[model samples]
Target: MLNNIGLPGLLLIAVIVLVLFGKGKVSSLMGEVGKGITAFKKGVKDSAEELEKSSADAARDVTPPPSDKDKV
Candidate 1:
């Protein structure tokens, strides 16, 4: 069903949305949407970085201490 909405359908939808909500409202809404997307991406990146740091720390902790026989 969605695949059937080609360029004309998209244009029509845009026109209807513009008619319902004026240009300024739409523009501001788009700006807010862009900001939201940027924030979401940043959050995801931070989370990934934190996860990597935690994994590295865990790996370091898992290392065994030097044995007495190796203390020659």
Candidate 2:
């Protein structure tokens, strides 16, 4: 389906979009979209770090306390 829309078709669509929404508006929209993607990526990275820290803490808690058995 996408292969059918060649370069000319893509240019036509872009022209139409520019006409419907001025160049400034389109550029601004694209900038906002990029910012949103960056924010989402940052959020996912932070969440992963937090999960790792919590799991490490849980493992430490589950570990048995050291005892004095057969002291040498």
Candidate 3:
């Protein structure tokens, strides 16, 4: 059903939305959407960096000191 909405359909919908909401409201809403997207991207990048740091720490090799029982 959605596939039938071509360019004309999209333009008509845009016109109706503009008439109902006006230009300023739409522009501010879009600005808010842009900010949300930027915040989401930053969060994902920070999460990936944290994950890499944790994995690297976990991969480090550590050897225990010689125990007294092993001394001859």
Candidate 2 — which pairs collide?
A: none
Per-prediction count of colliding residue pairs?
Answer: 0, 0, 0
TM-score of 3: 0.84
Q: How well does each candidate superpose onto the true structure, as a TM-score?
A: 0.83, 0.74, 0.84
Question: Residue 63 error for model 1, in Å?
Answer: 3.5
Model 3: lowest-lDDT 10 consecutive positions: 56-65
Among the numbered candidates, top lDDT falls to 1
Mark the 10 consecutive residues where model 2 has the least summed lDDT. 63-72
- The parts of candidate 1 lying over 4 Å away from their true place are 64-72
| Better candidate number, 1 or 2, judged by TM-score | 1
Model 3 Cα shift for residue 29 (angstroms): 0.1
- lDDT assessment of candidate 1: 0.97
lDDT of 2 at 66: 75
Error of 1 at 24 (Å): 0.4
> For candidate 2, what is the lDDT?
0.95
Residues 13-56 of candidate 3 have per-residue lDDT tens digits of 99999999999999999999999999999999999999999998
